[model samples]
Target chain A: SQELEQSPQSLIVQEGKNLTINCTSSKTLYGLYWYKQKYGEGLIFLMMLQKGGEEKSHEKITAKLDEKKQQSSLHITASQPSHAGIYLCGARRNRDDKIIFGKGTRLHILP
Target chain B: SQTIHQWPATLVQPVGSPLSLECTVEGTSNPNLYWYRQAAGRGLQLLFYSVGIGQISSEVPQNLSASRPQDRQFILSSKKLLLSDSGFYLCACSPSGYNEKLFFGSGTQLSVL
Candidate 1:
């Protein structure tokens, strides 16, 4: 069973600051996805990386996958209040090939 | 353009009660459907997934079960609910592939007392 571990269970940042959240997998990653969600809402897709050493960005948020495909990071530049949410990282498990998610990093942006 | 609809944004049930959650997708054919549960302070867990009608695969062994009766309809059912079942339920859909992006529903908050 493949498992994902996300760093910094929770984070608090002042508005206009920068922060980064990391997700590491127990096995080789086939695909990695980054999503944002409020406490009790559906997730909003942010980015998906399939190849090793792939990187993508949307607005002020950027995500990168290491060359080994075992680790991924999401970095937010110049954070704002709207960036406050639970950021989850999901990847396909090697055994079942079904997507599994990390515990997620709770982010709070202070206005 | 595809949209997913999940009913009864919230639900509260007693132990041993029956539970059913419905999810439907529009504007797509042969899309892969999935059911996920998010426990308090925990990440989303995949419970079930279906590639087509009447086909389902369970990820974890639990009191909950899922069925896909139609190409675009996915349902989660439980004969007897347990307090441990309290969590947030989400339905999502993606293209039939390993790397397609997932689109999630608004989610249903289930509290079993």
Candidate 2:
């Protein structure tokens, strides 16, 4: 079975609109990390969460990891065109450092 | 500070030709190196990983092979290129001895003609 799953494979929103993306895992995620990639480019690490009830933000983008460690959400507030890209969530279980990544969500921000 | 480099940013090879993709990391030692392939509009698929020099672990059964000759160097090769080899190839490194988040290279785009 796929270890990680992402919701709403594709999304489009007008600039300045708030949007959210979700990631769920079949197993508990000991560590969760998010990455963003632009077309024809490498993925850039966004943030990492190691605990339940953990929330981190970089500018307008914020991510939350529930205590259960089975799910996480990335919220973008007052989104902008620059936020348009593919977002991927990776999960590491227990102490194992090998991460399994979600299929990814393709986000499009229209001006 | 650490940086990963992959060469031949773009490649166009014909069927049955040999191929080689290289990846190197600097500013860090004993890093876990990985090779992955991403098909167009698809997610990343792990091909192989190595924890140390001369130690390679393959995650998928494919026509490709990987080698780690130096602590921070990894290579992906194929004796004969196949049409399925057309995709973006990425090299990633995690701090060795642990499961840290990966630092990826700029990636190489290969098109098999």
Separately for all candidates shown, the number of backbone clashes (residues 3 or more apart, or on different chains) is 0, 1
What does candidate 2's lDDT look like per residue over B42-73, in tens digits? Answer: 67878898999999999888889999999999
The DockQ values of the predictions, listed in order, are 0.70, 0.60
lDDT of candidate 1 over B1-113, digit per residue (tens): 78999987999999999999999999888999999999977678999999999999998999999999999999999999999999999999987775677899999999999
Tens-place lDDT per residue, model 2, A5-103, is 888799999999999999998777789999998977788999999889999999999999999888999999999999999899987786755666787
Each prediction's RMSD over C-alphas, in Å, is: 1.3, 1.3
RMSD of 2: 1.3
How accurate locally is residue A9 in candidate 1, as Cα lDDT from 0 to 100? 95
Q: How high is the lDDT of residue B25 in model 1?
A: 96
User: Model 1: per-residue lDDT, tens digit, A1-111?
Assistant: 788999999999999999999999968888899999987899999999988999999999999999999999999999999999999999975423777899999999998
TM-score of each: 0.97, 0.96
Error of 2 at B112 (Å): 1.3
Return the DockQ of model 2: 0.60
